[model samples]
Target: MPSGGDRHARDLIWGRKSDALRDLNRRRVLRAIMVSPGTQVNLAKFTNLSQATVSGIVQELQRENLVVVDGNDNERGKKVSLSNVRGVAIGVEVSYDTVTVAARRVDGDVDRVVVDWSGRGAEHGSQAWMRECVQLIGEVVRRTGLDETDIVAIGLGIPAAVDPRTSTISQVAWALDWERGMDPGARLQEHFPGVPVIMDNEANFAAYGEYLYGAGRGTETMLFVKSSTSVSAGLIIRGLIYRGRHGLASEIGHLVMDPLGVVCQCGNRGCLETAVGGARLVEQVRGAYVGYRVDLPNSLANIVERAKSGDLLCRRVLQDAGRNIGIALSRTCNLLNPEKVFIGGELGRAVELVIEPAIQTMRLHSLGGMFNYVAPMTVEASELGLKAGAQGALAYALTVHHIRPN
Candidate 1:
């Protein structure tokens, strides 16, 4: 009973809705493929699409050359992957003393580069780190035989909390003096104009990386603790990084451990960082050798190496740090009850020295249900190690729909 004009308007609105829904489904399929290639059945499960819908989408994508289907078996059994010709995703991790870059192709190939900037005096600040980041990105991209124009999206991970609303650095700990409120994504965007930039905390990206491809894979809930010049934690819930309000969800370092302990950078007293952070552990070892004629270990890595080589003082300090970290993690576990916890960063290199004590302490303080024989929670070393952050950044960049293949 509608008039001709009314009918045309209704039809247009329905057409738009249909188109939008189709595009969204296409994006979901593409994202699942980016995570890892699989058959139509697996893709259907991953994307939560009906098998018929997945088949139709796969056929459409194949015709457009966006994805390739292989195997001489039935259509449902063939593996589907993103075309190797698709543009690359770039991920960069900027820590206090290091800059790591990774370039990942749509076909699952990756090239990476890492540089140590500790010797570059602190006076240079953000400028020096940004410059090094640019160079490292360029180097890694070239290693993949790709140019700047071939970059689809970039993920920048910094050792500071990034405000999710503004995509800018919100809070910096004492270890990194990066300017507060600076938009690292915008700065990186200037270098690679037209490429979208995704910025987040390095720990968040590291957690995502481990969840996708390392120790935390197959877990619905996981925690990644990054212990370096500073201490921070990232939580992965259902395959997504849980960045809570203002993007400071898992800031375990600021957790109060002592009421009247040394003041912390965030103006807190007796934070977990004060007790177990890399700087504090290094300080403890150096304090032990003070006024002695013998040379002392200077950096956390040095302390770790000394500990591995039978330095009782270094071992004891790290063990204490591990115990304190366990205490903090116990509280966290009691709340979130993650399936797994992965320890990464510089301290992770000495897993044998730290993980056992941490586990012992955590078992003591955490709820007994967490240690039940069946499906017990476990803590392990990060399989991806220092590369987790950068690789995670790369994987995350690919997940964002910055650009569609032409």
Candidate 2:
């Protein structure tokens, strides 16, 4: 019993609702396509839309020249891909002493460039590291044959916790002396005006990278432990990086193992990092070889190489580190119960020397249910190695729907 005006108003509201729903559906389809190009039927499967709906949306996108259909197969069988978009997504990872950048075009031509520089300063709050990061980004993008204006989005991974709510560096990065509430993303955005810069913990991006293209590909829940100069962890659950409140969820390095042991850079005593971190292991090796008049290993990579070459002292240090990491990971496994655990970074390179001991120790300390014969939790070395963080950042940047070529 509505009047004419009331009926018209109701119709208008319904029309707006319908339009909004359609737009949302379109975005979902586009996001799925961005992740992996596919045919209309495969797109329907990925986007969870009806075949008819995917076909219609794809046809509309094709008409707008946003996507192109290729292959000489039938319409449904033809592969669909993004048109030769003029933009590229860039991923940058800032570690304690390194900056790595990766760039890829949205047109899916497999053209990508990855570059890394070592010995960069470790102060996350200082301008030195930021300047180096910007330089590496430019270098990598240029190698990809893309100009600065071709950048659409950038994903930056830092060695500190980022507050998810504010997108700022949190006090948890005390080891690097990063100021609380410092916004690295904002600084990068200044250089790439109008470009969206996404930031997260480097370990999180590394986990995402492994989940997308490396060892964690088939896992429903995976944990990636980056044992570098400092140790950190990242968790990926069901294809999404799990960032708990304050972005400190998987800070396994800060776990207090020995309350009376050496003080950590974070001011905590005897955290896992103090025991198994790269610096600590290197210190142990150097301490043992003091005044030996032999060519001693200077870095973790050198130590790993020496261990592989059957250096007993280097092997022992890595073995002890593996055992210590296992002890901490056992506690983490009891809580998150991930399907797989991947060891990445300098330590991961010595898989046979490190991973075997770590696995044995983890098996001893972890919950028995995690080691069931039917589906035992497995641990492996990262297939992507040191480049995981940068690759992950690149893939993550491309996942941002609005950043797609307009």
Candidate 1: pairs in clash: none
Q: Across residues 1-406, which tens digit of lDDT does each residue of candidate 2 receive?
A: 1111111111111123334677767766765665557778777865668988988988987887778899888888888877634556688888887777877655554324455764674554458778887887788767666667777578999888998777788755566756888877888788887677888899999998888768787689999999988899899987778899889989999999999999998888999999988888888999988899378777899899999999999999999899989999999999999999999989999898889999999989998889865789999999989888887887776564333121
lDDT (tens digit, per residue) of candidate 1 on 1-406: 1111111111111123344777778777776776667889988977888999899989997786667799999989999976634455678888777788877655552323332223332224778888887887777766665566666677888888999777787887655556778876787788876676888999999999898768787798999999987889899998778999899999998999998999998888999989987778878888878998378877888988989999889999988888989999999999999999999988888887888899999989999999976899999889988889888887787675433121
- Candidate 1 yields a Cα-based lDDT of 0.78
Error of 1 at 293 (Å): 4.9
What would you estimate as the lDDT of candidate 2?
0.79
Superposed model 2: Cα runs more than 4 Å off = 1-19, 38-53, 70-79, 109-113, 400-406
What's the residue-level lDDT of 131 in candidate 2? 86
